[model samples]
Target: SGTAVLTPREPGGLPHGLRAAIALRAAAAVQDEELMAHYRARLEACPGGVSFATFAVPGTMPEDTRLAAILRHADLLTVEPRGATRDDIEGLKAADVTEPDIVRLAELCAFLAYQARLLMGLRLLRNA
Candidate 1:
């Protein structure tokens, strides 16, 4: 069977703040009406998906914040220890990372987190 492609809906250019909130909610697997409404509103505002593409001379905060948020919601965070320079981060911010890149990065981190979480859960699942 072919793999299904899931594209992120554009959220009407909503501010990153709101968009991030919606994304975090979705990551948490929370399907409440309010969350859906927020996502819908953002999508209506930006039909082309949140401007994952930015040209603001790539600052650390946005990427840092996004990474932190993902870690918070994801079951695992994985670092490959590749040599990353400031320019790399800047480029990442400016370039539109292909959907495949995003998916791969997310999958790697999630897998790492999941494995760690599985072990932790096994040890603590019953106590809590």
Candidate 2:
């Protein structure tokens, strides 16, 4: 089964639509076409319809500390998890993100990293 992080453990803390949008953006970053399209549609059909085009451009994300924390954590986790520190965790806390929510967000990003690796491997095998 796919890692279904669309539904956050604490719904009120993080809405499903927002989670889906973030996941979609992460998928796009990794060039997972199918995953991106799936979540893109979900975001487009969300209650008020979220704009995810900016997701592809991290520099364009709103200047919200929470969002910045999430993106920073996602980047660090996927690119250089060994460099993560307590400050990283504290940053999310300073942004008002609950401890459990931070854990949930990390897990989601980890799953995305795994998905990206899987896609890359499959492509390489196909080419080989």
Candidate 3:
């Protein structure tokens, strides 16, 4: 079910490679080796995935304007979603991201948050 978010039937402006990179970034934020490994494999399977290697790292930023904007939003979504403001959406718009793509990104981030929490809870239950 969650895999569909990364590889949707209609990917729109966000390609599978970019989606995997963003997922990898979110997974890295939570320091989950298991999640990171999953996303890494998904990324590696994507075309042009190697170009997105830097994004998987926590502090690295992309030189491309659009990618930078997306990365910024991903970082914000991962680290402090509550801090996100209209300015962030405006930033994406300024970078030429379409409205639908913006929605796609938000959904991806939201899904990652849910996935992380669910994994953590399962781990806790297993340990218990």
Q: Return the lDDT, model 1, position 43.
A: 45
lDDT of candidate model 3 versus the reference: 0.90
Return the top candidate by TM-score: 3
lDDT of each: 0.38, 0.70, 0.90
RMSD (Cα, Å) of model 3: 1.1
Clashing pairs in 2: none
lDDT of 1 at 55: 16
Task: Give the TM-score (vs. native) of candidate 1.
Answer: 0.26
The worst-scoring run of ten residues by lDDT in candidate 2 lies at 51-60
TM-score of each: 0.26, 0.76, 0.94
Worst 10 residues of 1 by lDDT: 1-10
Give the distance in Å from residue 9's predicted Cα in candidate 1 to where it truly belongs. Answer: 29
lDDT (10s digit) by residue, model 1, range 1-128: 00111232432223343333333334234323443454455444543444432211112124554443333322222332244344544454445444444454454335433544564567587687
* Model 2: per-residue Cα lDDT over 1-128, one tens digit each: 13356564455455666666666767766667877887788777766446443553433465877876777676677667788899999988998888877887777777777777887888899999
Candidate 1, residue 41: lDDT: 57
Using TM-score as the measure, what is the rank order of every candidate, best first? Answer: 3, 2, 1
